[model samples]
Target: MSTEVKDGLRISVLSSGSTGNVTYIESPHERLLIDAGLSGKRIEKLMGDIDRSLTDVNALLVTHEHTDHRKAVGILARRYEQLDVYANQGTWDAMAPRIGKVDLAQKHLFAPDTVQTFGDIDVESFSVSHDAAEPQFYAIHYEGKTFVILTDTGYVSEHVEGVIKNADAYLLECNHDVEMLRMGDYSWPLKQRILGDKGHLSNEEGADVLMDVLGNRTKRIYLGHRSLHNNMQSLCHLTVASMMENQDFGVGHDFELLDTQPEQATPLVTL
Candidate 1:
């Protein structure tokens, strides 16, 4: 096998929840960000946690048009005059019209099923089922391996299952436990969305998603986008761990599970 030292990929999560969300991706040729759902101050703190600054980013990549995904979009773009933004037409249309202006000069349109690059990091975008316009997930490629990120969706659709199945790493949604979500104190309508096919994936559902994809090459799994009101981190970790244990493969021997902190930065996923 060839070494990937010349073009390694690193993913760092700043925050990931209703409270906020952001992720930093570092490659040899580019420094990029996935989302900016946090306030400027919070994102700054997160950058500090990673021992980097917002200035390190060459551009920002948006997943969808939701606020939790766009919490600091315009602010950061404006703050850093040279920072470019990449998104699908729907997402850009949904967000770009808001400020009645554009700051970043390089706003590229992302089409589904397209393969492109941000420096040495290869990126692929695919459609996802969510309430927002043209919601999507990302699959990043580098060094003969792929890392797929699937979150903020009601469920893992068959389409997504295909894209994520053979990934070496995944930042997947393990939002809540079915029982806790149903019996907890959320409004009826809100609860329905969380459970719907277009809603977030519960711990059990997330496990099912993983089961379909748990091959030998799955090196890292970080269960993300957990709900603070209805879910506990330990439950998600334990539930996924137990389910993986039942599988035929020696799940824990090579694969490691990390939970994204709703209030803090997760350790970088390196490959």
Candidate 2:
């Protein structure tokens, strides 16, 4: 018998939410990050929880140019002086303010369906629905296994659905419960955007996505990108639990939440 993963493939939620966002995925030969939204120091500490350092990241994959998702990307890249940023051109232009004056050679741009490698990990980006210039989620093939990360989007589209359907592990967005968002104190315009076709996913929508995507192959689940005012951790937890359990999606065997609060440091899961 052999381990499902032989080359040490793993992922850690570096940080997530409106404040900052970051997640690290690594393999014996491939080292990468999904987003770099936190400050340099904050991101370093988050990675330290999983015994990794900024220098260990081979590349940074940008989903969009939002402040919470790009704030630390340039700093992380510049400090390590080696991180290759992977994103579309529009997102790059939108991110110019944060990336500072990066060297031209360090930028790595790829269109949808294109795949690239970091050491041995094969990363493929697919378009996601959002208001940003062009946001994307990634599916990584490594050590003979596949994992997809879906986050920071207004809604899930056909392309995002296809990629996630076959994933082994998913770190997905479970932003807010509808009632909470509608009744919460957020301003009208902001609330409208949050509920728009290109806004973040609500708890019900997140659960619906799970109902459609979670299959026998999914090993673990991490609900993430929750809004503080628009969602309660308990509500988010119960909603997902009910959805999976009601659907009989291998209850308790593969379900969890990725905390988005600034103060949480949960144990890193290697799948």
Candidate 3:
């Protein structure tokens, strides 16, 4: 299959949830994986299904030290001799032992506040509220277009809103339905952790953040990292769409709305 990227930018969510999380982002000159939570073999298979190749990936950028987000980091880096795995110093220090031994040359560290250039794509990492060592979301700029990945965040701070405002597209988290989570079977401590300041975003909270950042320039929004039990795809879509509609924004016309599943790759999106 041809690996050529069309138009401005191409994005695909390889998987997104508690089980595993990875997102593919590419510019004309470079390809990147946002996270490598699944086994390396599985991630490669997912990429193959979308007519892309893991061999073509230039780097892997990790969000934090969570096992579900860095499960295959070491394996992939070892397999792909030239691949560099990027993360903050804290995340690297916290996740290194868990991911096993990666080649010394393959570990690349970036400060949260600085912009790192990868070929024609420029990546900027920003702080997020999560229980990891130092979790962050990323914004990519290429060909004058912006694509932001904002998931695994407990709450969107004012600074985060400003960083992602008016982006061309977004992969935002819609982690759970608060009511469902509250009444569900999870242990009280687990429930509290999921709802706390360092936990995931609920449908309502996700909608509010989108409402604050989305603008005319916004073209597509993918709801990501949905809980298997606490959130349903249809429910997440409905809740966020309704919120947008109430704010006088036409869901389909103003911007495309989609959801990412933990076991499937999303349709390749080009912008």
Candidate 4:
């Protein structure tokens, strides 16, 4: 058997979109799943396809209680037995009923703005504006590298931007095209919710945040949590790229830009 020593952090977007959202992060000392949105079997298959094992996951960090983000949280926790699930108390309480039973020992609570170390990786939860009890965006630190998993929030507060500034990589959301969302068949209330302060970020909004924070250390940016119904991957990519270019940020030179799909896993990005 060929032996390869795995070091540093490896990240992959298992799936991302309105249907479901999940991300796999493998630090040198711990394996983490940002959200267990898809069915347990589907998550397992995705992990397997990426040459990783679901049963080896060390933790499941749920951002919020939304069905699209917590569908398999409980099932995976039960099946794995060893997986430690982390979420804020508000999220745990709101999601517990829908996710089914998770042992008291297995459930862990993390407060916003607190940095908790699991093995060699340090995970910090930062408050985010979302229509949930308490949603958070994660900034993961390992071996001097930082990777931010940012999505599902309508806007990023100045404090959050300061905290996540100059990360090595980012899985940021570019959810929808505002025009498509406005002109689509969805009801007015739903469209309003998406465009509101507590809804998903549009391409313009997400790009604005990236333009402000990306720096010398920033390397890879994976645009995620896109709206399958209202956003085309090509359009989302072009929009973000065009905006960044306007600010003198050249794609593939300043940083590598990639899109995460709802049904497929992004290529494993190792930092």
lDDT of 4 by residue, 199-233 (tens): 99999899999999988999899998999888999
Write the residue-wise lDDT of candidate 1 on 44-120 in tens digits. Answer: 88887767777768888888888888878888887877688888888988887653355547577878768778778
Q: What lDDT would candidate 3 get against the real structure?
A: 0.91
lDDT of 4 at 19: 90
Per-candidate count of clashing residue pairs (backbone under 3 Å): 3, 2, 0, 0
Residue pairs of candidate 2 with colliding backbone atoms: 154-199, 154-200
Quote model 1's TM-score.
0.92
Select the stronger candidate by TM-score from 2 and 3. Answer: 3
For each candidate, give its TM-score against the true structure. Answer: 0.92, 0.92, 0.97, 0.97
Candidate 1 achieves a global lDDT of 0.80
lDDT of 3 by residue, 122-205 (tens): 999999999889998799999888999998878899999999999999999999999999999999999999999999999999
Per-residue lDDT, model 2, residue 75, is 81
RMSD list, candidates in order: 3.6, 3.5, 1.1, 1.5
Order of quality (lDDT): 3, 4, 1, 2
Off by over 4 Å in 3: none
